[model samples]
Target: MEFKLNLTQEQKLIMTQQMQLSVKLLQMSNFEIQTYIEKELQENPVLDAEYKKNDNDKAQDEIDYKKLIKHLEFDNYGHSSYHRDDEEVSPFNFISAKKSLKEFLKEQIIDLNETDYIKSMCEYIVENINQRGYLGTSIEDIAEELTISQELSQRCLEIVQSLEPTGIGARDIKECLKIQLIEKDLKDENIFKIVDEYLELLAENKYNVIAKKLKITVQKAQEYGDIIKTLEPKPSRGFYTGEETKYIVPEAYIKKIDGEYHIIMNDGTIPKLNINGLYKKIINNEDDKQTVKFVKEKLNSAVFLIKSINQRENTIYNILEKILEIQKDYFEFGDEYLKPMTLKEIADNLEIHESTVSRAIREKYIHTDKGTIKIKDLFTTGISRVDSIEDVSTKIIKKEIQEVINNEDKKKPLSDQKICQLLKEKNIDISRRTIAKYREEMGIKSSSKRKRF
Candidate 1:
């Protein structure tokens, strides 16, 4: 074969800065959009804020309630409720906002006249708490991070565990319970023996085996077990200041109206902005060529920015439209109706790149009558086997394990193998190791640790 010059017609896609800007805007949250606008205003002298003419504008606008009501599409569920009252309070209690576990622990550490280094280590340990109040990191990991000795890290960890929630800095459930047991200094003489020797059996609620091995009565072992349950599992949870907690402001709202789902963009909360009239006038006015050129360039840039914002809004609307179409059942029924979806699926459906779909949904949300949900939540990884009745997400699996463990007879809790077998019977097809992992993720102890009288 001889080489020949040949050209073929093919689709070519290139990501330009304009396209990038549009994507960036699409992915930005409402707060982020405001910040971007503010930054643009500062940098571009031509972009200026349009202030309301105060009471005069309001008084004249009173005649037309439409001016007061932002342009929100009213659905059959009643006109999209817009609060004109500036005094509308947040649903969350502002005054009694709980302190984060890290800050609360830090406050206690401040009273200790230790060196800054030790204080810092304590803070790090507190910050790494898992949901159930375990440190979730090894001493070696902490030492490596801080470039400090493991001994020092352990010391700080010990101090943190000594705080109000007894097991705050434990590495695992066993350790967490052990710390609590050590703190309480209970009369259960065989507590340590039981924890070590029968933790796995205990985890399965194998109280009969535990009592037989420890030579203790079932009632006594249960008494000790009950004491362990009273300890705080997660010490660091619920510690955000009201002001610091970022609320999810949805970009769109989906409502069920007349036995049908309807979608609306939530542009009501965002403030409206336009090109500054003064700058537009200057651009239009005749001036020196250099001045005119500079003004025109800046004006073009501003227009591009506005166009990007508009494109971002349109892309979000289109993506939401597709999601509503695909997940119509979920909106109507609830989570159980959510079919497994992936980024690739949406990309294929919309004829957009996968990354574009990812960017479109990133940090974006849809407010439903149920609540504000992140767009990402709509896409779930499908389970390997499609025959299972249970939801395929690991979270759902973990929850089931937790529920099983929670209700297990203290004398006979399920073992990892048994849990795996049970899940298999239910078509979950999880291995014993996977069961163990789910158990750990749920902050559950092993069958031995779970053993009671």
Candidate 2:
């Protein structure tokens, strides 16, 4: 009786290779994703990182590529765009140098389907950007040096401006911050004006002066100042300087466009992946079992990798879409408008498991006008409002407490209890302990230490 085999059906969860790939991809930071992609490109012949022309059209490809890129190559990742016919390119080899600001700009320039003249102009403009990430010379000087019209030189500078490191080629700090704000679709707004003209006043903590000039409240001025402070004055801050570089590549961009928010994946960091057409042709024409089987396996792996990468990106996009829909006011206005949100809330709304949402945002970042913030920062606990049934985000509470502390009389800074009472009067009821906790979390010293006198 014990020797009999029992046939029973039971449900069990299994992680298929593709499922495992997706899970791994969902949690990888942007640099990790790039490194993973580079590895795949090296190991999988079927996965093409970019066009490597067939031998038949190699001559034509050389001529076309020569117009824009003059032997473009990266010194690390054992990767380079230019290859000799006899050279063996290895993906497994690695060094540590990342692409510099100029190299990064030139890559995008070559990819642009623009005329060679325009490409050259863009390259010249990129070259002119100083280490501090500002255009070291005036547009007039560039035009004279290039023997081109000032309008054309300005246009070329604008092209560089449109590139990543969002404010590249800016002439001054005002333009640098303004360009970033514009990338966020915040042009000519209160924050933009504050950055454009009142930067010095803001630096001096002249909120009332700015408020009087802008016809807004002092609190609003302070809010704008906070947001402006988050912007980068030096667009080249994280760029490869002479030392070893550890640059942060943003996962996505949150842009408010035409009265609606849009989620744009940062495709610039991740190379476009394509299943090699040559692999398909070989599999169809080859008769050897070993050759066909090897091609088929690689092709399947390439397809799965592409699918997993796409699934990861879409999951991130969906999460951000939901976040934007819920927190549109925050993006348009300020952090105080950020609503109560959590991973569970996003999972429920997106109709997915909670961990999926969590992993999708793990170590991920979004480039916002406020700066590159962790996507995980978007999900926060709620603190109930005193006068309404609705809730406020802990982020909003923290910002409010910061503003309160910042504006308190330095000679007699407000204590935790007094801060709590002030917040209560404003309908944000919280205990002194919560206020103290938030203050500490924000790195604000105790009120006694905060006393200026």
The parts of candidate 2 lying over 4 Å away from their true place are: 1-14, 51-243, 281-287, 369-371, 409-412, 451-453
What TM-score would candidate 1 get against the native?
A: 0.59
Off by over 4 Å in 1: 1-17, 48-226, 233-243, 384-453
Query: Highest lDDT among the candidates is held by which one?
Result: 2
lDDT of each: 0.73, 0.83
lDDT of the structure predicted as candidate 1: 0.73
Residue 303, model 2: Cα distance from true site in angstroms: 1.3
* Residue 233's lDDT in candidate 1: 57
Question: What is candidate 1's CA lDDT for residue 151?
Answer: 90
Per-model TM against the reference: 0.59, 0.54
Rate residue 218 of model 1 by lDDT.
80
Compose the digit string of candidate 2's lDDT tens values, residues 355-393: 999899888889987788888887889988897999989
